[model samples]
Target: MTARRRWSTEEILDAAAELLRTSDAESFSVRKLAAALGTDSSSLYRHFRSKTELLRAVADRILLAAMDSYRPEGDWKQRIMSLAQRVREAFGQQPQLAAVWGRHASSGTGSRLVMEEILQALRASGLPDEEIPTRYHRIAVLLAALIAAEAGVSAITPEEYEQGMELFRVAVLGADPGRFPALSHFARDVRPLGADRHAAFEEILATQLAHIETAMRSR
Candidate 1:
């Protein structure tokens, strides 16, 4: 008889991530994962202590994938943009994974390495040592909020998005000009910079980088 192949940690995480992409967070569970793996719950327990632990690993795995191909080769601003782009691409591919960003504190090697690159970029920007932490926090908050927005948009179907946009158009375009002059005028004719989400991400990132550049100039 042939011996059975034990599942590796990477294999387990890959399976878990795929499962998560198809299901909402509330619906994901250890039993379900074990079933998906064609193994007993006890077998999964040997690798992950609990469902929560498994999820954190899966989230970190996404981060690892985001940074796996990063090659640092540019000025501080360019480097920052490259790193941010990689992260955006990764989250865009698996926005479901972004749902766990704030909920889990990723202490994995991947998270640490990413942070290191970010910090290096900040340091290279010539910000004072005293200002680095706050600046870093701001970047973190900005990226988290943007990625969460992308994930929220991804979670909805195209029909739902179109329906919501139709409602928004009705509300904005139909507003009384006398009562809401600016909104009525602006909302009526404005075009998006690009595909709405992608454009917004690029605009916001550029604005943030511009702010950093201004700070560097001031000092």
Candidate 2:
């Protein structure tokens, strides 16, 4: 009889990512992953210490993919913006993974690479050495929080998401014009609530970048 092929680390991570894509991280387990791979759970344990370790590996894999295509050739602002977009796009692929990273602080190689890239960009911004760390922390946390928020939207059904947006629109538009004249007057501006969620994200990112730029220019 032919022997079954042993699963590689890459294959295991790929399977885990696929499972995460369909089901949430809460319900995912090493046993379930082993079943999907047609192998014993011990095979997976040989590669990873535990489920948390395995998931962190998966998150690193995704970050590696995000960095694979990243080119840090642009100026500081542009490079930082591009990196942010790449990170967002990577999480967009498997938003469920973002939630995992959200709950657990990521300390993987991929996460370190991202931090290094951000620090490089911040240095290029002409920020003082002492201030770089603080700025880096702010930028990193901002990106993580915003990306998690975006992923939260992806976690829900399209209909439910749109319904929530519509409800916000109604709440704003239905307000008494006399009491909330400014809000009511501008409700039409936000009429298309869910049409371009990324636009809002990009705008917020841009604003934060602009603030950093202003600080850099002042120094």
Candidate 3:
């Protein structure tokens, strides 16, 4: 008789990470993950009792892998910014898992360690002891939102994006210039939203970090 295949937790997480990295977040499912692993969905239950649990595990692993080499150095704000960038890159690589991270609010060992690092940075920056959690939650949400936005951009086909741009151009040009002056003026130069998303994300994050510094000084 042929022996049944046994999957390790690490092996399953590796497959799940690959799926999150490549597949649209909405397309992720236990069946899909199982298929990717070349095993039946039921087999996964041996390691994870539910899809939610499995997804949380995947999310936790993704963040840890991203911050594996992270060591706090430089100014407090700079350290936080560095960690934030790592967070963004990690979540961006596995966009689908972003939702899972947010949904479960997973506190696996790796994620807890990440939280500690961020909180430590915030403490060093002089954020009030009581305000750290809120700050952390806000930053976490921002990172997740960015990842989701990146996933949305990836889902769009180039042809569709071009078609949308042409449609927008036609609408802006056809409208009365005086009534829609701003749109009319920018129509010729406006770029698609996803075209420069990475830059936009960096700008937004930079602004947020600046706010933290400002808050620290004002307090």
Task: For residues 1-219, write the lDDT of model 1, one tens digit per residue.
Answer: 865568899899999999989886678898998888887788889998988788888878777888997898788878877887788788778878787765664768778877899889989888887888888888878887788778877877889878877877788888899999998879867642224787788789879889978987876
Off by over 4 Å in 1: 1-6, 190-195
Error of 1 at 113 (Å): 1.8
Per-residue error at 96 for model 3, in Å?
A: 3.8
Ten contiguous residues minimizing lDDT sum, candidate 1: 188-197
Using lDDT, give the best candidate's number: 2
Cα error, residue 39 of model 2, in Å, equals 3.2
Please tell me which predicted candidate would have the highest TM-score against the true structure. 1
State how far residue 211 of model 2 sits from its true place (Å): 1.8
Per-model RMSD to reference: 2.8, 2.8, 2.7
What pairs collide in candidate 3?
none
Report the C-alpha lDDT of model 2 over 50-154, residue by residue, as the tens digit.
999998888887788899967798898888889988988999989999887766656788898899999999899888889999988988888888888778788
Looking at model 3, residue 62 earns an lDDT score of: 72
Residue pairs clashing, model 2: none
Global CA lDDT computed for model 1: 0.81
TM per candidate: 0.86, 0.84, 0.82
Backbone clash numbers for all candidates listed: 0, 0, 0
